[model samples]
Target: MSLTHDATLRELPTEHGVLRYHEAGDPGAPPLLLLHGSGPGVTGWRNFGANLPLFAEHFRCLVLEFPGFGVSDPTDQHPMVAALPAVGRFLDALGLEQVDVIGNSMGGVVSTRFALAQPDRIRRMVTVGGMGRAIFSPSPGEGLNLLMEFTEAPSRERLIEWLNSMVFDRALVTEQMIEERWAQATEPSTLAAARRMYSRAALEGMAKAASTSPEPPYWAMLHQVRARTLITWGRDDRVSPLDMALVPMRTIPDAELHVLPNCGHWAMIEQKSAWEAAVLAFLTRKD
Candidate 1:
C-alpha cells in the first residue's frame, strides 16, 4: 500500500533473520541505502522522509528497519557491531556487491562497522550525526520508554516535554508527530524490547560497540576502508556531537566533513535540502 508517496514496503531475508525494508525510486539505478536513527517511532520512514524520494529520483534507495525497530523484530539482542555482517548478508540476498550508504545515528555506527569490516561492499559512505566516540549520550531506549509510559497512560504534557529534549526547537515537536510516536511506543512488545535495550548489560555493550568497533582509539580496522566518505553533523546535536566524531572525519583518508547550522541530532530531517544536496554531491563526485 502506498502511503505518503509510492515508496513500497518490502522484506528480504538475511543470515540472522528476515529484514523489513522500504524501496523507492528506480531499481536499476545505482543503489543507495538509507539507515534510520535510534528513536521511538524511528523507522527509516521517519528519519529519511524528506530525502528518500529525492534520492530515488537519481538513484535506487533502500531504507531498512533495524531488527529491533519498526516491523522488523522485537528484541535488543543484536548489538550494533553484531549487525555489521547482516548488512553484507543483506547485500548478498539482494545480489548487490556494493552500494552507497547513508545512515544516521545508530545506523551510522553500524554502517561504519560494515564499511570497516567489508570495505569492498561499500561504494561510498555518508553519516549524519554518527557516533564516532564514546560519550555520555543519554539512552534513546530510556527516552523511548518514558515516552511509552506517557502514551499508554495518557500523559500528553509529559510526552511533549520529552520531545523538547530531543529536538533543539520545541516548536518542531508537532502534536501530530508526538501522537504518531506515542502510538509506536505504546505498542506492547516495542516497550519491552526498548526496556531490554536500556538494561545495564546492553548499555555496556553499546559502549563497547562504540569504543572497540565503530570509532575510537580502536580504529585499527578503519584504515582499510577505501570508500570515499561524507560526515554531516547537526551542530547542535547533543547525541553524537560533531566535536566527538571529528577524529573519524579527519583521520579517514577519504573523508570530508560538513557541519550544518540551526540543526540538531536529526540533520537529515531538520535540514532536508542541505543534507540531500550534500549527500548527492558526495555520492556523485568524480574523484
Candidate 2:
C-alpha cells in the first residue's frame, strides 16, 4: 500500500494519553519505529514524512508522536521524560515484542535510555544526532541556543533562526516550512511545553540538578545496550555537535558511526539519500 499521510495515520489509547503514530508497510513485516526530535513544532509526520514510503518498502514503519509535542496529548511531565514510557506502552499496545528503531535528536536520547532499561525489546537501533554529551565542543551548542531563544519568545524571526541552524544549507528553510512550524509551535500548550524543555530557566535548573545528582548520565551506560547501534551524525550539526557521537561510538559494544558531510542536525533530511542508504544497509544486513 502507498504510504500517504491520511492512510498511515493511527492512534492508540494508553494510560498516559492517546498516542498518535503513522504506520506504513505490511503489518506482518518487521516493525521499525521512527522517533522524532524535540524541536519546536516537531512531529512524527514532519520528521519522517519524506522517508516513510522508502522505509515502508522494507519494514513496517511506525512514526510515533511523543507526548507533550502538539501532535499528541499533552502531559505534565517533560517530553523527554515522558517519551521512554510512551514508547514501551505504544509497543505493548501493538503487541510488539521486538523492533528496530531510528531516533532523531531527543528521540535518540530516549531510545538509548530505553535500550539500557529494556535491552531485549530493541533489535537494532539507529540514532541521528543528540546521543552523548559534548567531549570537546561547548554543551548546548548554537542550534540549541537558537532553539531556546525561540522557545522563550516565539517569534517568526527566532523560528527562522532556529530553522536555519537545523541545516547546513539555509535554502531548506522554506516559507511553507516556517509557516507550518510557526502555527504549531505558537499554540499555547505547545509553546508552554517548549518553554519547559528549552527555556533558559529550565536549562539552568536541569544543569544545576544534574551537577548534584549522583546518577550517572545515560552515555555512561551505553555499554549495557544489547542492540547493535548505528550512530549517524551530520558533520555540521550545531545543536548536538559531531563530537557528541564520540562517547557512544567508543562505548556501545557493537556500534558503528556514519558521518555525513555538509549536513547539520537534520542529517536524515539534509542528506536524505546517504542517510537512507547507510541505515537501510545496516537494518537489512544479515551479519
Candidate 3:
C-alpha cells in the first residue's frame, strides 16, 4: 500500500532506526525536506503526493517517513525523541549541508525542535497544521477524539469521519482519498501500528500523553526559532487550531501567517494550488 505509485522509495540507517524516504528534482537544486503529521496510515506520500512535482519544479524535494511509520522499521524508543537524531542521520547520509524544511502537524513539531537545536541546518521552515507550540495554551478546537477515533474500530467510515473533522467543508474529501486511506488502514501491519500509537506504553509522553492531556505541558520556545518561518493553518482545523498559529506569528521574529478559509488540516490536499504557491513564494523570496 505504501508504494502504490511510481515514486522511488529508498532506505538508509539512522541513529534512531532505519529510515525510508523518497526524493525528486535536480541534484543541484536547493533541497527541501517534507515531513508529515501523525495520523493513522500517514506517510510522506500520503501527506504530500499532490505537492512533490509542483515543488520539485523549483527545488529538490526529499520526503522522509517517520522512523516508526510507513515502511520504516519500528523502534521501541519514543518516536518523538527518536525523530531528532534520525533526521540528523538522514542529512548526513545525503551530505546535505542545509535544507529548507516543511512539516505538518507532528512533523512540524519535529521541525521546530530541529530548527532550534540546529538552526544552521535549516534555511527556512514552514509548518502547516502544526503542534508543539501549544505549550503556552492548548486550544482543542471542535473537541474531537483523534486517537480514539482510529483505535476504537478502525474503518473507512472512521477515517472519513476523522478526515471530515479536519476540514471546514466536508465535501472536499474525495472518495478516492477515502479508499486509498482505507486500504492503508486495513493493512494488517499498519493497523497494528495504529493500535500501538494510542496504547503503547513506551510511547507515553510522546503520543498517548500528548493526545489525552489537555494541559500536557509543552516547551514552545518560539524565540529560539531563528530560521525564516511560515505558519499556515486551516481556520477550521480541530487538531491544531488557527489560534495555535498566532503564537508563532506573534513570537517568531521572521514569521508570517496565512490562514486558509474553507480549508482543513490537509492543506496540500484540500487546497493544493494555493498551498503550493504560498510555499514556493516563501522559500524563493530574496528578502
Q: Highest lDDT: which candidate?
A: 2
Those runs of model 2 whose alpha carbons end farther than 4 Å from true positions after fitting are none
Model 2 local distance difference test score: 0.92
**For residues 13-123, what per-residue lDDT tens digits would candidate 3 score against the true structure?**
765568898877777999999998776667888888778777878888888887666468776655666677778889989999899999988888889888888889999
When summed lDDT is taken over every stretch of 10 residues in candidate 3, the lowest stretch is 135-144
Model 1 C-alpha lDDT per residue in residues 18-91, reported as the tens digit of each score? 88788887789999988777655667788876676678788888887777664675544653443566677677
Sort by TM-score, best first: what order? 2, 3, 1
Clashes of 1: 0
Residue 270 CA displacement from its true place in model 1, Å: 0.7
TM-score of each: 0.83, 0.99, 0.85
Q: How far is candidate 1 from the true structure (C-alpha RMSD, Å)?
A: 4.0
Error of 2 at 26 (Å): 0.6
Q: Over 4 Å off in model 1, which ranges?
A: 1-7, 13-16, 79-82, 134-159, 204-220
lDDT tens string, model 2, 150-264?
Answer: 9987899999999999999999999999999999999988888888899999999999988899998888889898999999999999889999999999989999999999999
